[model samples]
Target: MIWHLIAAVFAGLGAAGVGLLLRLVSGKRLPRWIVPVCAGLGMLAYQINHEYSWFDHKQTQLPDSARVVDVEKGQAFWRPWTYAFPMTTAFSVVDQDDLITGQADGQRLVQYRRYRFRKEYVDQVTHQAYLMNCTSRETVPLAGEPPRPRTEATQTFTETDPLFQVVCQQE
Candidate 1:
């Protein structure tokens, strides 16, 4: 976070220097406030760029076996620009190499972990284990200390669901 602040400050300073040079080249025709405005715009541009590229940046950090299952785009009233071009604020990933497949009672089951990434002050990551019944198109989280299946929290998915496709594609 401190590094980002430092970079923004440097970006603002560099833009301000450019504004100053422009004013000098124009023989003082440009107003003095132009430098400060340029500096502010530079800092804002840096912050916007950082936010817009966050999803791709996080994706690049994941392994090749990891598949993206879900994505969430955010738009805020304060950031009106986001409504025009939404930014990915959260996503879910599943790794193919970590899947544990099995068959019981003539039903195909797959055990896997779902990794959820949220863009926050610290870039939060929350993961949960799941037992997916591919044959029935149902999934339930393996919760608790011993991680038993939480049937109450079970969810059913359709064939087109990304999570279901990734977890069942191998079988």
Candidate 2:
């Protein structure tokens, strides 16, 4: 965060220098306040670019095996700018090893995560799935069948929510 602030300051200074040079070259016809105005604009531009590129920048830093599972948008108010801002981009990643090695002994464990971005910080949520071990003395739940030993069963009607269906199913 401090780095970003320093970069913004440098950008503003550079823009102010340009404005000052323009005024001098133009025989001082330009208003004196233009220098500060240009500086403010430069700082704002740098901040905006930093915010919009945050997701891509972070993604580039992740390992190649990381899989993106979900994404969602978020909104917040920037008090200093006096505006309601909408950030439309976010990402969720899952380690491939966790997903592949988790399914064993007739049991499947899954890891899911979600990420949301705000002006102040990023929010992350994670969930773990523990299913019955297949190698254990447990029976598998059959589709449309009665509940078996050590298995929990449920019926999925036509109107069932898709999100619930994905998370609730046993692998």
Strongest candidate by lDDT: 1
lDDT of 2: 0.55
For all predictions, the C-alpha RMSD in Å is 1.1, 8.8
**Candidate 1 residue lDDT tens string, 43-146:** 99999999999999999999999999999999989889999999999999999999999999999999999999999878999999999999999999998888
| Candidate that would win on TM-score | 1
Ten-residue region with minimum lDDT total, candidate 1: 162-171
Model 1 error, position 55 (Å): 0.6
* Cα lDDT tens digits for candidate 2, 1-171: 678889999999998998899899999999999899989988988888887677677678667755554555565465233245655356556544343225655555333322333234543444433232322322223232332233454223332433223333434
What are the lDDT scores of the predictions, listed in order? 0.95, 0.55
